[model samples]
Target chain A: MTIEYASIEQFYELIEPGLNSVELAVYAASITTFFALILVLYKRLHHDKLNTLPVNISGFGYAIPGTVLAMAMLATFGPLDNLINEWALSLNIEEPGLILSGTVFAIIFAFVVRFSAIANGTISGGVEQVAHSLDLAPLSLGMGSIKGIFKVHLPLLKSSIFVAWLLVFVEAMKELPAVLILRPFNYDTLSTQIYQLISDEQLEQGALGAISIVVFGLLPIIWLNKNEEKS
Target chain B: MTHLIDIQQLAVKLQNKTILSDVSLSLEAGDILGLVGPSGCGKTTLLNTIAGFIEQSAGKIVIDEKMQIDLTNLVAPEERNVGMIFQDYALFPHLTIRENIGFGLFNLDKATCNSRVTELMSLLKLTELAERYPHQLSGGQQQRVAIARALAPQPKIILLDEPFSNIDARLRNELMIEIRQLLKSLNMTAIFVTHNKDEVFTFADKVAVMSEGRILQFGSPVLVSQQPNSWQVADFLQLGSWIPVKCNGDSAETAIGSLTDVHTENCQTGKTESSIMSLLVKPQHIRIENNENVNVEINHVGITEQGYHYIVSSLNRTDLSFDRLSFYSHDVFQLGQQLAFEIIHHEYLMFDQAPPR
Candidate 1:
């Protein structure tokens, strides 16, 4: 088949809308929050009596199909919003209609639940690679455990933390099923737009967005290769 | 000698298994105590327990006549004021040598910390490598950095776990001597655990031999070597080979000959039943005899600076065959050749033989 390239002006017009979409903004914001939440949860649960269980529980989303995860989130939040609204009404306050299920919150929630394992696994592996003696070395030198972790472990885990964030960001960008089921009205991400175009038998029009996803996916691979070579 | 650290009946249990028990040890100020034992005899565990890394199940650890710890309360490792040098050095790889030495001094002002780091770097001969990271340095240099870091805080007591085990054999003794001098010059009280008994002779003021989570003997290196309290202590030290003997009151009969001057310090005099005993036979105590038909076969021979040392086993038809007794000879002897020998005049040390299963 002969492929026709879009003119520069037409290309700019086609790609600019996708880049400026509210779905992209939500993706960025949700992923930032998700990364922060992973750090907070990992830090809190790491040394607890539960050990890795809390992190593993959060990682359960990775084992389930994204479609199943989307349905589970919908099932959970759809009624939680109603219960909140019902309580608001009983208290004689204005009803906050579908506050969670009818907005970007549900989509972000699904993304976080599905991709937490990647962040947890990366950080946990990084933490494990550090010698247990290194953990106690600072303690012997008169530094508290919390301070020692910050001084010693966090600096050591810098690359791993960045890698985890990048991986989750890229994964969230390409997620389709969860976004498709959980997105509010009029919201469209790169993957959803590509999906919509393909469904309409106009895959050629969505080629640039699909290629962007591929380009993003190659980043960690190149980074890992560079690190291995450096080492 | 003022005691800097006193451990009273310290016992540790991990996950329902006893790791250390009745480990009572006392160290004077500026003294170096070597914890020598076979593998898995709780040497490292005792060090960790004293360092506050492991919680004790019973007894107390009293330090510098100040801090005290028992089962109910555990002073956090950070708050214990006890320093430790691990086998792997455990230097913060991300930090420079100067920074590592200054890590314990982080709470101090910048100038004071810098001065302390400089002082330690000079003391440990690491001033030239101060800018280098741990991985950039050699093993011995990294261990020096670990020592400098551990000492930066001026801990009341320092614990080292197999500190020199990773060094080259030729360099290990030199490093031990140098570190011993450094510790002595600084008047630092420290305890180091190692499986090498010779390290104790070269590096420690007092040596402890441990087995099955209990300290078998604790005394000066010379004292422990001169008089090992138990069979296990002498065996662990490998001070001498055992010569089986039949004990009859004050006298003992051996394969080499009867020992009329047997020392009964380790045995009871009025035993109703005769017992089989083993005499500690040092290599210097055995002398070559001119007689040819004595049935002593040279099992192995190796050249030493003193002479050719031969390990001869008794081929005598007597029931008391003393096997693998090391004897030093000025002349080389062929392996498996029969020779005559006699015990020189020496203080006899004998112990009851282990009961056969």
Candidate 2:
């Protein structure tokens, strides 16, 4: 058998479809925003009950296997997708079918379900590192609870939030099993494209895509090491 | 009108354990109250409850006799117009000194806020360090920034938790005096907690001694030292060593010698069989006698600014075992040196001893 890929340009050309996909960008942004909002809401609404069930359950996703999470997402959203499509057909909306499960929504939903724990854990740990007295300081200084969080806690957690976002972004970029199961037809993120190339025994063509995933995955490790040095 | 902070029967229970119980105290508008107690004695809990960090389970906390907080309806810390200086300073490490001080002044106009920050910085001697972060400042400077931040909003009351504990012991007194002057100049009503009783004398106008979630006594520092209401207060403050005595009506007989004019204010008035009582023997009240018989042996000795001080224990164990009396003089005494001393003429502060083992 002949190896078709000969140069870096060829590898780039083969993986360009995955790199330039708007759906992948949208999925990454969607998961990041969704996780951040959930983490902040958890902190604001139930700060006193941080160790309670609600917060712990929200962070439990980190321990879940990606394949199991993908299947769980499918089991929940697939039926809901059908119910929505049937309603749309009855309402005479032109061509509605499998809206959530058939598009990038499925992949984004799966990503959020699987990776939210990373963001929540990082942000929670950051919040914990701040002296509880600092939170009370703003309140004693004439700031309300919400205002105190915004003025004091958020500013202090800025670095943690950035690190959380970067970690989730990189993880999403390189995650394979979940995206492979949840991604709709013709939707190819870097991980999904590289996986398909390997499955087809054409890994040489997707070398640049695989290298990119490895490079992206190294960011969080480097960041954690730097933080370890700091502390 | 007599009180600015009127806490009536305030109680706080956490996780089924009572942290503060019926902690009733009041402070005048310009008075500073110092809370002193051993570790885990609920002093910090009381301060936190007043600062609105911990919710009270019962009773009421009234501010200026108008705003009252109780079990059912609680005022948030911000709306209560209270301020706090945490022990660690908690100076918003990410913000510069100016920003931290000006944080609470956000409600003011920009120019007004700037002027207020400038005034406070100069008053606190933090002007030169305005642009520096908290980590860069020395401990004392960070403390000043924390004070400025707490004072920025001009709250009716402020709470401080062991603010001087982090300072060098040598500089602690100087800083305490400076901060006391600043608070007095501002006419700020405040409550501070410290385990060190001496701090109450140097920093506070009033002292409240607490033990096991209860206030044992609340009075002027001098008053508390002179007359601690309970054994816990006397022991915690270390007002004087206890010399066991046999009570006989108004007077008591001690190891040093039989003494008249013993005050039994805390005991029953009527006569009864001789019972054990503890006589408060301060160092100043003991006089060294130049006599043939040395009645006591030096147990310990230490040098002080006034002179060398010695703790002398009774030589005869049956008279009173392990009972120590302190004596201070310019004359240096040798360790284990036998000394004869007599109790000088003074009114005694005596309390009944717990039943013997």
Candidate 3:
């Protein structure tokens, strides 16, 4: 990390050669998995202007056991990888696994399983509240009751989402298994970079990386919660 | 203009339990029929059946005679051109007033749908609310928009579950007047269902008075008031009870003096000695004694918290000594005050045990 060879080109060469499938898979899954999380969240929530990277990594980033979701993603992605390989063979192409594992498919598969559960829970909870407004049947009467909820239900809940996003953001900064198994080799996310430096016992450098990720996570949550509570 | 709806003996049984027992009625074009009853008395079930939201277990509902829809015959609510206004005014919250009205006119051409919505908005005075969603409006405004939305499609028949229940009491009368006028002027066959007797008298051209699960009386407001079929009907209509009177021909010998106007055949004429023959008298017919002819004493008096709204009657006559008569007067009377009057008219007439038609 400190340029032992005293040359930037040598450092770059040393970093680039040691990349393997495990690292490639992890980085690919992490970034694409983050995008997939955004997609699911976008479908469930439309009003929030907050970005998805902080949310995707922080909320369930560490909560999702990387081994289980990673294994599941591999199984799901295996068929698609084979199909891509067959197409590559038909076209006499050199790379097939690149299309399957190194691309967005592997990452999306892992994150979808996580976010779908969250989206389903959130949407259904809001819908259940609308159902009990009256004993009257659901066709229109139940749906009619949700309008008022849609308004006041927002500003009051902004603080909660902000806090949740912040806590999850910090957690994502420290996520281990998911960062280890999902990231692609060539990629260097903040979490993975910290893991690499820490693994080498580069204490000062690893500490710096860790501090940056935590700061990134906590700042938004505090700012949002404070501003919202003020309003 | 024509018969918009006709139901013949609508006997409905739900889960082996009878909900409606042999119900039948019809509405002509431009007629506003009011269906009145207590809660859970099958009024809403009847409306749901007519709207094709429920399949009756028995009987027939013929719309225009060509469509022989009945208890056995099933039809979806959306398929039938019956416009329904719910008690709570079920306006779609997600949609604006224009969209709500437009939703009903999906089958119409674009220009026609737009024009129809505009016309209905003007008709119901909902022009300003066309762009507003239901949550933005007050109860009265939401009700008007609901009416407008139902009217936009111009269904052959409209069903108003409870036209005034959701609106404030001060505005209920005005809304009733406007709704009645709208129904009449548009020549749309409709039904107004309510438990309030006053709303029935004001808003409906025909009324079906129901109790339990059966209609006690079906006729104009005047007939239902003047001549209910049984003692129960008379009582439910608040027309007072008929006391026991011995009659000779048309002249009846009873309490307060000999009565002459009642037909003798209407009373039990020839029965055993122990057979009970009861005479009918309304509270209004019995009066406070001001003259020295009859001795009277006030039992109780005071304006009730409910203002006596006159729905509840003070018990003036007992079964042994005094007779009851039906009366209509807005004036408040004190308890124990001596009131004197003659039986000028009847609140309702009665029939022998054979039961009236």
Task: Give the B-chain TM-score of model 3.
Answer: 0.85
Tens digit of lDDT per residue, candidate 2, span B1-357?
579899999999998899999899999988999999999999999999999888899989999888889877898778888889999998898889999999999789999999999999999999999999999988888899999999999988999999999999998999999999999999999999999988999999999999889999999999999877777788888777788777777666677677776556644474433777677778788888899677789979898886887888898677555446776899878899988778888767777653122
Please say which candidate is ahead in DockQ: 1 or 3.
1
Which runs of model 2 end up more than 4 angstroms from their true locations? A1-4, A7-16, A20-51, A89-95, A219-231, B266-268, B271-273, B354-357
Name the candidate that leads on lDDT: 1
Tens-digit lDDT track for model 3 on A138-184?
21211221333343233333334334334333444444555456556
Query: Compared with the true structure, what per-residue lDDT tens digits does model 2 show for residues A80-170?
Result: 9888878888888865777777777777777676677777777777777888678778887888878877778778887777777777777
Candidate 3, residue B73: CA error in Å? 5.6
Checking candidate 2 for backbone clashes, the offending pairs are: none
Q: Give the CA lDDT, 0 to 100, for residue B137 in model 2.
A: 88
The lDDT per prediction is 0.82, 0.81, 0.62
Worst 10 residues of 2 chain A by lDDT: A20-29
Worst 10 residues of 3 chain B by lDDT: B307-316
DockQ (Cα-based) for each candidate: 0.85, 0.82, 0.06
Please list, in the order the candidates appear, how each scores on TM-score for chain B only. Answer: 0.96, 0.95, 0.85
Lowest lDDT 10-residue stretch of candidate 2 chain B: B264-273
lDDT of 2 at B238: 79
Please identify which of the two predictions, 1 or 3, would achieve the higher lDDT against the true structure. Answer: 1
DockQ of 3: 0.06
